[model samples]
Target: MAPTCPSEVQERKILRRSRFGCRNCKLRKLKCDEGKPRCKRCSSFRVLCNFMPNVPDLQPVTDDSSSTFVVQGRAQLQPPLTSAVWTSDASTFYQLDAKCQDFVTRYLGRSLITPDDPNMIKVNRKLLILAFTHPFLMHASLAVALAYDRHLNSSLGCRRTVEECYHRSQSTTLFNRRLGEPIETRDKDTIWGTAAALVILAFSAPDARTPEESWPLKSSDPSDFEWLRMSRGKMSLWSIANPLRQGSLFRAMESTFAEIHSPLPEKGIDGIMRPLATLCHLKDSSTPGNNPYFNAAHAVSQIQDLLDSQVKVGQTELFMRSLHGPFESLLRGKDPVALLLLYLWYRKAGRSIWWIELRARVECPSICSYLRLYHKGYAAVHAFLPGGSLAM
Candidate 1:
């Protein structure tokens, strides 16, 4: 201990005084002044100075062999107190489930059965990501996936009906609760997401009719029309979300709607449609302007255009596009002319395996009686039936 070096003494004093650094300084691998409110480095960079909360005080360990002692602290530091804190909420936990994540991923990639419009795909992906934070939307999305899976694979040794029903019931209850929430309290993104989820649910869920129940004029099945009504509601909510409408997500959805509902070119369906329009006109000439036939004609023209566009693009998109605007109400009316137009649309839509499966399993048998009653004497209608004149 004779003639101890002054430099060594100074180094030991400096080391003893050093404490843990601020989060920013640690990230930057620099020395921290550990100033209150803001560190020197953070102040210089004009960034928020953040320190770890509830950190255990460091204790210096003495070394018997050497004069220098190492400070012992946590090897891995916690995130800054200012950083976002994630907690376990119902919504967060639901989205974190591997099954739900996988379903959402598959849905975003392959659910629509279309030509893969990047914009539509991007918007759907964003909706699913946003759903993680929104319990209602998360449930709605899960419900749709479950319903679609049940419909497609129920007979293929899939999950039990009881389990599927339980989950769907839960999801539907959550969705309805959100729907009933006061408009002022809910955010616009949540509303839009709910609407989108409803659309998917409409497509995926089975009709409300029992197997033995025959199709009536209105079908009495809520499933047949629930999605349609929900879609209209979705549009209504979308109208209120003015700021959201400016985003690419809204633009993509709008563009898809426009493409789906765009007026049909005259040439594509004029041949088959000319007879139907004439029949509609002959059936009710009293008020030409207000006639369903005229309305049906205009609607069929648009449907034809939709089919032609799908052909050119080499893909068959969702049938919901055909349900937009007046067409939904018209189909619900059970007017023979409107039904005829729908039949033709279904035929064209039948070209897609998706539409074929839907028609054979869900739609055709449900509407069989109504179609037969209306087409009683007409060979044209017979031809369009499941095994009638049409090859489809």
Candidate 2:
């Protein structure tokens, strides 16, 4: 070829030697200004400010992407390396479903109830107990909805429906009388369950003005009040179980998650175990048919099984706060199911802790309610039965 122009010759020389583009521009695939010290693209991007020398005077920067590099063979950079950044934009509900299948499965029977079905009623009653007494589930939107939905299928319909029942029950002032007429009138188990359910409903009252107060009745066993002493110590049953034993514990734990279906920290439930233990005491000691303390202890021990193989932190907290009032009553020695009723009342009132505790303290007073009821029941037994004194 004829003599090439100097500028054209230089351009050909640089372009011919390069593979894709300049090193800095190739990583980002951007246009290079080809400035001295650093290319304009690299400088604008705030990348490393370095120039590739035409001749090898100084060693090229070491490829220490994996290893730490020492400056002057003495010290290393404080942080190691810069990796690629990641980003995503996805649907929350989709992510929630993907992550929280286990939580959804726990309330399957309760949440999927059909009206006019006996099984549905039983499931609703059980779920009501769980929702009314579960502190963690009560606090979360998803958990509460899941547990409450189960109740809806059994007898109630939805959040709005439950609120309507709460209001209607308020007008009756028999907020605890779901089986008010006692259809069969003679099944002890049914009677006991109804009594328990009514007791729980007392706690479920939405406001002092509506139902007026906590349940007027009290538990008839010392075991119910005894759980408060256990609360003073560390490591409640909720703390001891890795995953927990009862299925109900996981009822409302789906929507309130941090990452997609990620497991929560193991010790997450440890803080609330004492309170839960107290709830078990109230539930167990409602009647005198068995050693309520032992029964309560056994029920609480099963809480470990209630946890999924893996737990989520946010969901656990959600379950705990939702049922805090019932658990707290367990600590203070209220009737288990009755306390659950109080929980429902709080639930109806949007589950306000201040309102629940305030009404409970005003209505139920303290642990003395259960103690007095037990003493009265004990006296009644001795006064009426021939060998009551020797029955123990």
Candidate 3:
């Protein structure tokens, strides 16, 4: 027998760089941006933006978890539909089974926006219209709604279900694809909406079932406490989207964002707890640039003020946003001192923020466990936590 040649041994599959690119870009011989609503080049060139992912009308399926739930009990994502329509405005298209379609239509808006705030009603409707037009936004909304549903309805602290992860993966793919392209003015709110939803998802869903498996007490990885990084990333979108700018529908969230983002005092930690102050090593001489803990310290101080005022609002993103890299790294690296500071903040934040109470259910206890197990000598610092002696 002749020796087989390497070329004959294996046949390579040739790949097309523009596999999902729009026809106009392929015609113009340019790489398509592959974003939704319209690709950047098509939007700039002012032509019909058409491509293929064409979904044949999905024959309406009966109500069943077979299509909507996990393929197995594992957290594996559902495979996407292969074909889609030529003229649809969204990025990816697939049929939601009857149960999912109904859930999204009925409970999704309420899961996201508070009905108590009359202003949020308009925000909810506006987002629904945008979600219809932008598939990435739609998936992001679904992921959030599903997670919020589980949070509200679960009898115990439950792990994220596979269905939630599927929409999250889909939204992440399309959202990142759009972020890479030349951002058109019209796509700003859509982009912002998706970013905001993902931020909520990040905060609300962690993989662990109990505090022992949560951050600090749990093992560390590059992605641990991802909510902190996500909060920072969403803030960067503000310059691009400028939700408060005239004619932007997202301006409806302005009061909510503004409420949590009240400026730090001109010069002190007046509202901050003395125990937290000492834990942070804050001094009259200390300023943000000089002390790594300064910003985290300042943030908790503001939270203290909010709690004292009996403000009913709650978006604890303030803790993540106000942190500088040094302090954030300390938290990510699972430093006891850093975890102690966070414990203090978490205890205070949970008092008023019902949503944060869900996270504190795991993390706050984990911090106490970690301190009790490893840093027993730091009795003074650990005292700030629940069951610890040092009261704030």
Top-lDDT candidate index: 3
| lDDT (Cα, tens digit) per residue for candidate 1, span 275-336 | 55555553323232345344345444444645443542122333444455555566766655
Off by over 4 Å in 1: 1-98, 109-115, 151-168, 179-186, 208-214, 217-224, 242-244, 260-272, 282-288, 305-335, 350-360, 373-375, 386-392
Global CA lDDT of candidate 3, please?
0.66
Off by over 4 Å in 3: 1-91, 111-115, 259-261, 305-315, 351-355, 389-392
Segments in model 2 whose C-alpha atoms lie over 4 Å from true places = 1-200, 203-298, 305-330, 333-392
Q: Estimate, for each residue in 1-392, the C-alpha lDDT of model 3 and write its tens digit.
A: 12222244233244455778876576444787798857887666544366643311111123443453212123245454554211124334444665467667676655244545667777766777777667778778877778767767874468665456556766777788789989887889889888978887887776567765676665676767677778778888889988888988867778777866766554556766777777778777777777788777777666655543354443455666666678877777777877876876777776655445567778877777777677768866656665557655
Write down the TM-score of every candidate. 0.57, 0.20, 0.73
Candidate 2 vs candidate 3: which has greater TM-score?
3
Ranked candidates (lDDT, high to low): 3, 1, 2
Each prediction's whole-model lDDT (CA): 0.48, 0.31, 0.66
Q: Model 3 — which ten-residue stretch has the worst lDDT?
A: 53-62
Clashes of 1: 3
Model 2 Cα lDDT, one tens digit per residue, 1-392: 02222243222123222353355464333455666666565545444433462311111232332231112112233432334211111100011221123344454234321223454456555544433222112112223333344343533111223222322222122212322434332222222322323322333332222111223332233433221232222123223321122443322332422322333222222322444434334332243233233322332232333433233223223333322343444435545443433332322222222212323333432222332343334343232122333221
In candidate 1, the residue pairs with backbone N, CA or C atoms under 3 Å apart (3 or more residues apart, or in different chains) clash, namely: 264-302, 383-389, 383-390
RMSD of each: 25.0, 30.7, 14.1
